[model samples]
Target: MPDPARLFQSLSDPVRLRLLRLLVREELHVQELVAITGLSQPRVSKHLGLLRKQGWVDQRKEGTRSWYRARSGDDAPGGTALLPTVLTLAEELPQTDGDDERLVLALGARQAQAKAFFSAMADRWETIRLRYAQPEFDLGLMGGLAQPEARVLDVGTGGGALLPEFAATGARVLAVDLSLPMLVRARKRCRGQAAGEVDFCCGAAEALPLGDGACDVVQCAMVLHHVARPARVVAELARVLRPDGRLAVTSFCAHHQEWMRSELAHQWLGFERTEMERFFRLAHVTPGRWLQRGPRSPDGSGNGNGPNAADWPEVFLMTGIKDADHGG
Candidate 1:
């Protein structure tokens, strides 16, 4: 066989390799990647362009801007497995920084957009909040905390949709949002509840204000899509979980078809079982079980009723535990 030297050359630099790693987790705009990698916009774009020519990356255009994701092959369903050794190699390498840090690049752009997105829609938040964040989903994953008194942290609390469900579960809830206006709406939803019980805060998902291992369980609803650095967010969620804490995070997995792409713009990445497993690995979170639900709107667009039957089978739900052993 020919030498594999040329194959290795494409991913030689820690920076280029790191960019590919981020692409695997989610598709990302080159401009947005600047924050994650701490590199200039041109530099990130250059690396992405090179990766594309190597057939190791692919680009999807949305409006005027373009986003890049790892291309396994032909956009086929279950393509995540096509480059396993590359992914495995990526997993073992130490995380790079400055011009090669994925977290730095991913979070900066996303938090700003998320904050702005929520702030503008604050008025209509309550309607969206009441819709999709269901307790039956959380209770099903973590039944131990069904009591009248439990504590939960709804990370990426968005407009506080999951907060009330958590509160209804007898868990005194803390809803944190990067957008102050969004928090205001969440506060409005919990106004009738006693003070100090259901509370809200203005914060980004990467750096939650709560103390370490502060709550019994932490939840993130469809909001994972809004996050730039999901692995770090998961790490933070794991950080705040009690040793035996449970985590229920819902994320969008790519549909088995290429046609679903146009609708979920800004939905940079979709997870496969391995992809999800890798995310938990980076977060030090562990997967418990995988579940599937209807094409319900993650943004809470439609009535809380499940997604139209036509959109069924493409959506999925994943529940994981913060393994006490995995905690640092």
Candidate 2:
């Protein structure tokens, strides 16, 4: 923690207070922060630097872009004691009429970029998956499916890639996604023998359209990094899961692949295993087994032998089980 004098000095600025409020609501890049706060980029960055130094904010750097967010309560030095005072003071201050509206616009732009990318690439995902990851990632995550007679949900089931696998388990299947074009492709792809047994819904992961304790298993493959708020998604997944329900997530481990954001409309480059574990713990779920593969050989002979093996990062499947006493 910084000295008390310095701490209060940092908090004295309205710009910093506004920035703290904005970042607490969302993790935003420098550009987005500038847009939302209606502040010059340098002014925003200057205050963020001070907030970060005081452990009041966290910054994630990727290539040339940096994402900033208020440090989570658990990570803040005096958050449990000081946050209430800080927030109370903030609430008593002048309200910025346009900040919330601007924030929504910023986030909507991010979502739209992803939707557009998926809409155009819905059909090519099958071929695209082969380019970045091996079968091990998908196959390992599939192990989390529930037995027949149990219900299973595939959250953000892009192109319904795993619909057939879910159906073959003989469990009732539901596929949910944000992209309609992707859902259409998934429906068409799963129309074989057990296709009639599967269901589909177009929805967002952050706010799933499902009842409490809805299913025995939830599989979210390659989906977390695409969403703006993955922790919220995790909580939503837990909200709809039954007691002891399993949650399986397949995603790329943290890496410096900047191309993914532009080429794949990825909101995040990837995620750290520890980061994912924290997400599960916060949602009151027990972290389970983890399976991983990748960083293929230069000769294209490793786990995911694709051309330019050095370009791909590690991929992993992380699973968790809802505690019997976990809240719905």
Candidate 3:
């Protein structure tokens, strides 16, 4: 059991309490904390250090920045007992309109930075990505999960990186994306190799063009967060996959990157493991292997674990199979 007196003492500072309130909603880096709270770095670090020592917060180092989130449940001492009360108290406190305004500015700055990077590198996207360490997952595994001549649907198949992989498996591929320019690039990339094996379609993930039970394997890579309704897209993916077919999705894990929305056109920041599991259950897809990887460098040159690792998004790869008895 934690000392109740010490816990109360920790929450006595208004600054610490405010920090806890922000952290409870989203994981934030020290710079974000400073920006949100209008506090000096020294003061913010001091308060965070105390919260961490008391086991009221957890920290993770990403590159040069340290990210902090409120700890709850089994991860926190005394579980949720004191923390929930503190959070509630923090919420009940007077609101600071300036904090909200500053937050908007901070997020806007991040969005501008991302937008500029993407705009400048759009033509050399693939070459620029090679500068960072690529995600270390065997895409070849998709071939084994697919049957020969299987109808494979690749939703949001940006430049068709995986189209050729599926094509090489002898699966007839349908690569779909909302962007006609991206679809054009994808078609060109897979030109001679995927010649007759692949078909490019301009379509949205939430409303795939194909009929129900049309595909044996449905693969979506890093696209769900961009959709307006991720759950609907999941349902659509499940609907299009035939019984006993597989659905493989790769996406970012939950994070505090709101800039993604304005800059990269992401709808949701990311997803939680529980949310993904719920989607699988709702879709009647039996969840299978799950894997998570930390941020990779944007240049694809260094291991993501290094200090120089680019603040790339943390990603996960999840798969599920449609139940044999499931009716689309």
Candidate 4:
């Protein structure tokens, strides 16, 4: 029941059509569109305004940038009926070589900005990370398995973010980190908390200082990417865990954000679910379940856009249990 006349009128403009075509591929800010289309900011904005008026595009603002995406299916008003046809036509058109070149340049610029920001704030990384909205996962589920006076080891306890969560279960918590400064910050964060006493230790993930079968529950949050030998770390975790002990790991999934390697000191981009499972198998642990969590807006907004929206990483939780037959 859409107005065909309005839909046709909206697509009549070449600039608007081109903008829609580009937006259909991925959400883009005005600056990216300007670069991709080789159009002046004013001209791009003019075309975008017309498209917005026709309900052919949707916009989400994050800080100073406004990201726009083409509306399709039920989202497009007058064009809903012809959305498929329009997308097909757009795909059939040949893309300009210059547009592709400009897109590459724009992507590189995004990587540079992220790298500089991370490099400048490496010491206060945790504080900055907390500013963004993170996907919510129930760590409390692990608490139910805790027994009386259970020994829990938190590997790579950066700023003790998950220490309090584990401590609240009345488990004796041991926090480990490679950086002395990070351990200091973690200690301060856990001070005076109602959770049971927490012990801090300086250690490498690949070579933990604790003895064999030292812990009942091991939690590693967002740390696997930083270790040079992930398999070795997994082996160490398995070695220190008692038979039937639990292991919980949270980390980014494989992504193409190459800047993370140099700027954030990440050794790996991330691990796929199968790769994580294989690591567990090699460590003589039984893999449990894998849960994927996608990125969200920084302010808990549901607009699917934020300051880090362009390169936000997807995270996952992989759990496993040490096999009783293969005791450490």
Candidate 5:
């Protein structure tokens, strides 16, 4: 193993410094480092090699590419403090924040009673197993992310589908869910993984029992629409993200899916792009993108190349920076 002290020294180079900063938020490969730090591939590789020798980082192979991440344990080359310090410093930069509300109240009651409902619906979970496990929505939400060796947090993780793919990227994954049964299922799904590679915690999204700003990317997919108080969930998601960290939340836009409308058995609001903007404003989170299928045509037919009905009701995939002003 490389010495942590020496590893810290190797990370002192400017390009290495920027690379480490970016990786502290999300794992990136050499090409990504090259793109972000404006360094040549050889220089990036050299720094990474030196850093690896010092035990500051670790790499795992996926297909033809290798992704690097901060290693855990005392042997970690970055030493105990280096990566944390770099992450803290990065958080001082400008950040963003995001929210929604009253249907939330009703959702809370349903969530509280989720055990019974989901238990009865467990069989159905298997039907949607592929859907939940490999949600196409995640492709859009995680589009810009997916770093090698990243540590990702999946909040309100149902059926634990997102966990495996994140793990497949060789990133450490932590999944939290409010429903006990859901957590049980998630744990079962990740059984026998390498230690620290995957973890499941039972907790509500509003009161996560995690260290502040610990995850590089915190994602909540398809869960916000089910929360009784989604604004509070937004605040919590923002709270757990490091200032430079990314939060991508995927939920139903107020209108799109006929199934979701029927599932909720209400005239559930689909987001007007503007209304969605307001939701983010309430939580002090700046919206990054409004990913949608092409605009809908008259008579509700989506414009060609727009997202289909199955991709909906429309998915409100939004990303934001964690506001530093609202300290967790």
Candidate 6:
């Protein structure tokens, strides 16, 4: 818990307050904060160091990159009204509106970088993916989610992993991806799989290119790690799913491999299963089933890249159902 007087004092600086306002909305890298605030790197670091010490901000470092966000809810400072009060007053500050605008650009830059990376790697994405594991077995595990003649939406269906499996189910499958090259590859790969139709759409996961309640089953295989905002993508999945529709997701478990961010264009280094559950709950999707493939050490550390394949981290499958009560 943060001391009451110090916590309040932390918000006393207009400069520090501005950083909090941006962080409360989105987690930002240190360089991004410098750019957004138009401040020197040392100044931004100074302010962040203070907020961090006061327990109003949280920080994470991956390799050389560092990300910071305002600590909120149970992790935030004790006073419930502190952030709300700070944010309300901060909005009137001259820098608030510019911070919002710069934040959008920063986030957009992230998505654009991901798009470029996937587009470039489309031809050999499968080769890169195999380094993790053969994902077909993982996809096949969720095959039962598709019913005959049901509408299935496969987000991030890179190289058509989920398409061929679902094609035999007699379900109408829709494959979506932001990379045109990836979609082209997926279409060609699944063309002769004996499926009648598999529609391919070029779209990002954060804002799926589909109408509300448009799907009976939505599955995203190994995709959450690639997107800039995984939680928002889950909400978008719920938006396209009809009430009681099934949602299946597969991805690598949390790992320490920072190299994946540069080599594989992974925005996140996988996620904890608990984080996936929280995403489902926030999206009004009820988690139903869980499975894991691959291996993990006793300490829950994913120490892959070692000589033995046994050192690899596990890939997990999680299934959820869109709730009827969700307004989506």
TM-score of each: 0.65, 0.92, 0.59, 0.59, 0.54, 0.88
TM-score of 2: 0.92
Name the weakest run of 10 consecutive residues (lDDT summed) in model 5.
Answer: 95-104
CA deviation > 4 Å runs, candidate 1? 1-107, 126-135, 138-149, 194-196, 256-270, 296-315
Compose the digit string of candidate 6's lDDT tens values, residues 1-328.
5567877888889999899999999878899999999999999999999999998888987546788888887677875766687789999998878888888998888788889988998988887666555455555544668778889899998888768778778889889998999999998898778465688999999988889999999998888888878888999999999998999888888876666777667777777878899999989999988877774332443345542345445788889999987756
RMSD of each: 7.9, 2.9, 7.9, 13.8, 20.1, 3.5
Measure candidate 3: CA RMSD: 7.9
Give one clash count per candidate, in the order shown.
7, 0, 8, 0, 19, 0
Model 1 TM-score relative to the real fold = 0.65
Candidate 4: Cα lDDT at 179: 73
Q: Which lDDT tens digits does candidate 3 get at residues 255-277?
A: 66544554455545678888798
User: What is the per-residue lDDT of model 5 for residues 20-59, given as tens digits with 9 covering 90 to 100?
Assistant: 5555444455665565555588988898887666656677
What is the C-alpha local distance difference test score of each model?
0.65, 0.81, 0.74, 0.74, 0.61, 0.82
- lDDT digits (tens) for residues 102-211 of candidate 2: 98888788778878888898878877776655566566655656577778889988877777876876789889988999999999988775633799899888888889
Between the candidate structures 2 and 6, which one is better when assessed by TM-score?
A: 2
In model 4, the clashing pairs are none
Q: List ranges where model 3 is wrong by over 4 Å.
A: 1-124, 127-135, 138-140, 298-309
What is the per-residue lDDT of model 4 for residues 272-319, given as tens digits with 9 covering 90 to 100? 788799889999999997877666543343332323554656778888
